[model samples]
Target: MLGAGSLRQQWPPAGKLHGATARGAGRGEPVVDRELSIERPDGSRIDVLLNITPLRDHAGGIAGAVNIVQDITARKRVEDELRASEQRFRTLANTVPVLIWQNDEDARNVFVNQYYLDFTGKTFEDVMGVRWHELVHPDDAPAYIADYMDAVRTRRPWRNLDRLLRRDGQWRWFDNYAQPLFAPDGSYAGHVGASLDITDAVLAEQALKETDRRKDEFLAVLAHELRNPLAPISNAVHLLRHPDGRRRADRLVEMLGRQVRQMIKLVDDLLEISRITRDKIELHRQPLLLADIVHGAVETSRPLIDQQHHHLEVRLPEEPLTLNADSVRLTQVLANLLNNAAKYTDQGGTIDLEARRDGTEVEIAVRDNGIGIPAGNLPAVFDMFTQAHRAAGRGQGGLGIGLAMVRSLVQMHGGTVEAKSAGAGSGSEFVVRLPLAEPPDEAHDGTAAGAGAAPLAGQRILVVDDNQDAADTLAMLLDADGAQARAVYDGPSALAALPALRPHTVLLDLGMPDMDGLEVARRIRADPAWSGVRIVALTGWGQESDRERTRGAGFDFHLTKPVDLTVLHAWLGTRH
Candidate 1:
């Protein structure tokens, strides 16, 4: 309410007031003004200003006192309200979850919330006028302070991720943001700061980015590896057709066959990687002799061993050790390891494959004296797309999927694999352990063993492929073995030749562009005239699914190219 009364009623005593005025009648005296609060009759409050003056005669003697009173309750009430608002704001700032702080125009602490004080384990008094930098992580404080000052000078909102020293004496990450504060008149006041813990979120994001980076690297490496062999194979094909081929034909064909085999293995590894990662690859389990699989792996990797002129020593238990495993897949596992050993070892280096029976499991180890794995990389060697260190001048041809597939296949069969290396030049070893099989009534079938092909004379054979060089070369090889052979370019042409040629066997390439080998085989099998003809599928794809597809399409034999000449001839001899 507004002041409604006169000053005369609120004055001190009347006689005193009159005396003060009488004393000041003849003299000029300074005036003193003071504000005071008083209670009204209804218990309400009002404020007023009182002006007092002393009057003196010309002789300089006080004669009377003069008092002037003014009502000023509104100003006092506005001041009270301002103080109350500030108190409530402090309460709010203290109750929030994040750390909060503020600094004045000169960068002096105006306030720090209870939460911030709690984190620093300091009382409000301890840090009342102190800078906030003391609580920042030692490693991050310099950058933090620089950024803080930059924002202050530019009057810009700023945010950063950094660690702070917490009350428990440990550093923890937080995302902090600060905005400049200004007074009503647009004068610089201070900055308001808030910080929230974001350690986990940042870690998760970093991990995701790393995974994506590795995946991209893997794809690039795979493409480079796959393309390497293709260049040599393509060149070899051209070389085989050159006029000088008559003199160098054997050499060219051998090199071409090696590269084709390399490419097939690469394709198989790519497919196997997908299957292993998705847990889709299956193992066909059976009881087998451990020596048999070891021998197969050794034989498969011998060419590389011989090429490098490495001295290889094999040691196996004198007694026949048995294990239950998928024969084909088990052979693949050991062969991949042995090939890796040969590839990494220097020429004429010593390599050893040793097997032993320990308790309920068999340990097959492939050890080589060559460039070994780096210590830090051993743990990740069996991870998909991971490989041994590549030397500056040595370019080993591989997609880096072999060891990963080996581990996956081994684990699928209830076994484990491990890698060991002294360091980069100290050589390396890989050990695979499989659960042993109990004694069985019958020994393993010797189908996985090697054999030579018997000669078949005057038997008619047809080779069909989209690649002219492949078909022509296969036909020539067969013709050289005393069999009458003819080459066709595609499925349609092969089918066209069947009626007149009446071949005993058709070596069909499954990946032809038009009228695929499968369709051609189906048509040939449906006819009554070619009842005695045997169809063999030759293709680059050798995954279990590819074999299943050919088997379903009426192929009597499924052989992945570049097939061993001995194996191909043996199958042909059987057909004859």
Candidate 2:
């Protein structure tokens, strides 16, 4: 046996000793050789060499030597676990619906999962570095880069909306929600984001809005077309019931007229509701006296008031209260309240109209001792086609649109209207509040107050309509009023005839197949040849907003179909 200190001092070098010991081990003997793989003493790998000998000695009595094992069990187990973890990460990335992506501060693609590759139809080699921007929409790439750089600079989450291009050359909206990975020192390492497609939701919302617009438009057109003929029918019936007709004929004509008026009112109500729903109502605001509005509304509703035998009281301030409002629409609002009061009240029921100033607003109240509204029906009363009482034969109830129109018109004037009642049969009161302009010191210019009756005399006018009867009848009416009237069907012909006829006023019809009335007006206005022509639009499209649009398109006036003779006369009198 060799002493340990002597063994160390007299020992051969490690490599040589290992080789000799491995060879000298006899057959079937266990031999161990130790050698250092690493140069550093503190950190080194031990290579454990095992020796294997044959059962029988070599032919010359020498034993055989074998390098049997190097024992790397711990290292192999660690490698297996790492491989399994990487595979699990890959599976997770592929399974999620969101796109998992990693990119550097420059927006260069560092790594993308199999899910991203499948969606983009691009290989890893094709999408790396600057090529990643090509997968984004052209219009969105610059913005995306700016936002990403900003996120990196601020060390914040990278969240934004962007359009990404798909393999089929279509673009989709994506919500990119990402967080910036930071080092221990708070330095930005890279960005990891989850991109979710939001295109479907956006498109669905747009589709819903578009469909609603179409529905409103359809309802408006249907109502207008149905009501236009009712006006003429009502006028004709009124004319028929004269002293010349017998009692039976007079009675029949009156019945027909009443029914026709009811139908017209219903259709008008529907059209008004549709226009309001589509955000198409436009109020033509001007300086108006509240007293005059109330007076006109009461006068217009006199027939109903008389029929109901209702007691009406009106209280107006001695001094004038001037407010900014659309007079015609305000009249309609007051008349609707008056009519409702007359309808719901008993024969001897009392109604009162009161007006006063509250701060900067003028408040008008219509109080009636009538059947009151139910609590639940109060809010729904303003909804279209939702009447408290749904009756087909009764004249007391109506298609529910007037109150809605009133609300819209009041809002347009920067005002509000409200209704209050204790309960049914107890009574109801409607209050309208309008912003009033302080009375100007100067005497009010009565020019707008007293518009002279329209005088359609000795003026040159042109009537352009596709319907022969409409054009001919209008021309006759104009001719009867002492104006020189001419007719043309379309834009080109109207333009061609304008040079010779030199008409001062042109009544243009819209919805023409050959160049619309808008185009005709444009051409006439654009022509240096005819600068003095006053263009008026006559069409079945009667929405208040539609009129404003036509007026903006250069038409001096807009009128719905089945034109009222009185209004026409008034408009003609005002023309330059």
Candidate 3:
């Protein structure tokens, strides 16, 4: 119903349609297919296509124009909707954290999200047409490409883990997962994929596996080391029971003592490592002279040095050097290093202990011309349960916790320790650095104040333990030290014997059947008649909390079992 006259009336004078109409009328030609927008009386607009042509009169001259219009509103509306949807999709893809991508049917990347571009440091054009594959690590590209091509051919989901090179030139692990994309007509449209960074997770899993492996190795080594001491002790015991044992009794007894001491040392190292891991070991720090500490450590490791026949040298600073540290623990740390050097060195090898002030810190170094540590092991030398490889036929006995304990103890005292070596066959040195302290207000005599006195000569002492052997041996030791000692096998027997013996001191073990040491201590403290007796806890429980518990239960002293005879004698000497 849109005639030429009506169309002319509706259109503006300067409109494209008017120009086309005038040109068609004057030239007597046709203006075909020009698009125009038409507004209705109701204020609604629609798109239309216009065609104008000139009509000829009988005189062969131009006349008015004839116009034809076609509606194209639906097609235009669909185009706008598609453009907006594409914009929305691009915004969503760019906003995510993971790498998002799309590919064509030929497996060429056609579109990639902003994250993908940023990760690879490439533009859209640079990444298109399989150029993104350049970012895949060379080690991972071949398999990745093959797997992707297979997925594309089968039009199936795919997943893979591979390393990709970042813009910074670092290769990081990624978990790539993709699903096959298809058109509305069910034709293959390549794939839509996402890649997530999994570098941290991969590294953590690897470390966990390594730790588990080390734990298994440590367990196996511990079993072998424990069995080593048992064999010697067993042999000595058999020899002592022989018919002619008394003639060779002294030598066999000495061998037995040495084996027992070795086992006790191994157990002590294990306990110390446990304490360090739990952060439970407390340091009783004091102001002490470095010379004294060195002397004590040398004494402690002397027997081992002699056994190994390693010549030891000691070097100290000309001026006295003092440090604020736990005297006992510091001595133990140096002793462990010395023992390590002695055990690893060959017979007649020279070992050196040197102490000197380096600026504000004192450096104590133990150096040995023994089998050196491999360069690879130098970094892990202080790690728990780690040991340097030794030459065959020169196997040394240890639990590999000594250096670990040394590191922990030094760190506790605000110090640092380091192991240094050129490489295998170049010898090794362990250096400990501690902060120097101001000299004490008064000079220290460098001697134990009340030590070296004869032990209790006539004091009555009671030894109580569930292990009969432990109780009898302790009583025998006490009697040798001139104490009237009696052995009781349990806490009840200990409590019953106290009235008859009226002992001045009671050495009680904490772990017993029926009545524990705490109950016995409490009952003994409750009795007014036994109030003056000093009750000492002798057990394997040596933690700080264990000491606190015993103190609360009325124990005057606490001693860890396989008690040091010298320490027990010192306490007994104080009783007089």
Candidate 4:
């Protein structure tokens, strides 16, 4: 089967065959040639080897050679595919997103993927050997190593949730899984693993759980707070129903008023918090004397502080400090802080409101000698819905939004608020810092406002409401203040009396069956004779939208019900 002339001239190429054919020809046996390949028409190749022998006529003479070619293409193809598969595996490991690693039998890392190398800021040499633990968090390294060793010893699949230190020195969570590799004879060789980043998932799960817990707590606390006032109000109503109530009418009325005031406070807080959460509370900022602001806040909070019998001290910078701020809201802020101090302190405890100017800001601190905030809860004291949970039913507690609202409002004013406490029995302090501004203009006479409240005397006032008690009581109070007062139960009756009475002021209720306050105001304004009449909205609707609509309906002022008598009286005096 050989090409006779070509083999005779050169049995094998001198360059490749060297001395193979010559040796085989001398030995008179066959020489198995090395493997080779020939390219086919399809651009693929076939592996073949030449087996040559001496063609002797029974005399073993090297006259010519018998060349046999064997096709080893199938075996060669399988070997080449194995090598290619290994290359593909390495490429995939290097390109994947997750950090991947492989270790040798000695618990030494032999290889790490490109992701691991780049992300950990480690060179291949640094990651090799038993240096993998260096990449894990210091706190997690020991546990990871112990678990890895156990898995290797048992030759079993393993998994761990670990935190690893990144290149930037930040610790990141990872869910790592590994499987042991083995030699064909079933001896343990090494392990291969991958780590997936799970930081976001873990944090999300924790936050969701916390939110669910807080929601349940908030509902319970809200119900308790609402019921606190309801109980006193209900008791007051029962007391008023008794015949003897008339004899102690003044005391019963006082109790009833206090309970009503408490309920109104709760409702107002709810409305304010809702407005703040929706970014609905608009501030009207102006240059204001800090002393005037503090005085107004003191007036608002004085009733509670006196009720608690807390010794109060007010300290201010004598030079008349100032803040360009919303007087109403800032007054609210200071009052809230003062009110909190009175509520939390024991009867006869001492509380102080102190203010001073630091380098670039003014710091106001409300300090109290009472039950201190817990050390652990100080950080979360201003967190929404988080409470300084008091002892069993002893506290006239609030909805816990007071400080949270204070913080939010202060931050809105470009200020900061923080609380300081000495463990439990050492009392607490809340400090508020606001950036300083220039002094007031010369037109601002240092004489404070509200010092000259005009006496309500000889003024004709008409009180209108659906409730007989409210209308009658308001008229009585007005009459007691030396004013000419009349009470009417319905808007129709008030309208009927309007022409005859020709009152100077109309205190109208907005939620009547026959006619609302807005309609009443409109009808009054329609009469040119009543054009000069001052119309005020004295209603339960106190939302910003409610005020806007009232103004549009020609209401001179919007006063939410269970009105602050000081504010009401002052407003009425101005109108007169």
The TM-scores, one per candidate, come to 0.55, 0.45, 0.69, 0.64
Candidate 4 lDDT over 1-576, as tens digits, reads: 254323444545467675343344455455546677888799998887766664655564447756677889998899999999989988999998899988887778888899998889988988778657777888888889898989988889999999988899989899999999988999888998899989999999999999898778888888888788789778777877888867877887788787778778878888888889988776655556788988999999999999999999999987767776777888899999899888878899999999998976889999999788888889888977777745423356677788888998898788999999996777889999987667534443223332223256657888888989998999888887667889997878988987777888888888888688889888888889888888877889987889888878887877778866656565665456
Please tell me which predicted candidate would have the highest TM-score against the true structure.
Answer: 3
Poorest 10 consecutive residues by lDDT, candidate 1: 445-454
Model 2 lDDT, residue 193, Cα: 81
Q: Write the per-residue lDDT of candidate 3 for residues 219-337, one digit (tens) a residue.
A: 88889888988998888788888999888889988888888888898888898899888887766555578999999999999998998888999999999998877778999999999
Error of 4 at 171 (Å): 5.0
Candidate 4: worst-modelled 10 consecutive residues by lDDT:
445-454
lDDT leaderboard ranking? 3, 1, 4, 2
What is the RMSD, in Å, between candidate 2 and the native fold over all Cα? 17.7
Flag regions of model 1 displaced more than 4 Å: 1-140, 163-173, 183-189, 198-201, 204-216, 240-248, 315-324, 354-364, 433-576
**Model 3 spans > 4 angstroms off:** 1-5, 9-88, 237-250, 390-395, 438-542, 547-576
Please give, for residues 1-576, the per-residue lDDT of candidate 1 as tens digits. 222222333344444343232222233454445676778899997897766765555776655556567778888889899999999988888898788888876567878899888888989898877787777888898988898888888888889878988889878799998889999999989888889978789889988897787789778887887788788888887887888867887887888787878788778778778888977665555557888998898898899999999998999999998776777899999999888989998999999999999899999999999899888889888977666665434448776788988998999989999999999889999999999987633432223221123154668899999999999998888877777899999988998998888899999999889699999999998998888899999999887789789888899887888977756764665445
lDDT of 2 by residue, 189-298 (tens): 78888899899997998978966865675465456545665666665566667675465576666766776777777767777777767877655555678888999999
lDDT of each: 0.81, 0.74, 0.84, 0.81
Decoy 1 TM-score against native: 0.55
Clashing pairs in 2: 454-573, 455-573
Q: Provide the global lDDT of candidate 2 against the true structure.
A: 0.74
Best by lDDT: 3
What are the runs in model 4 whose C-alpha is more than 4 Å off?
Answer: 1-37, 41-92, 95-97, 103-110, 117-171, 179-191, 239-250, 389-396, 438-576
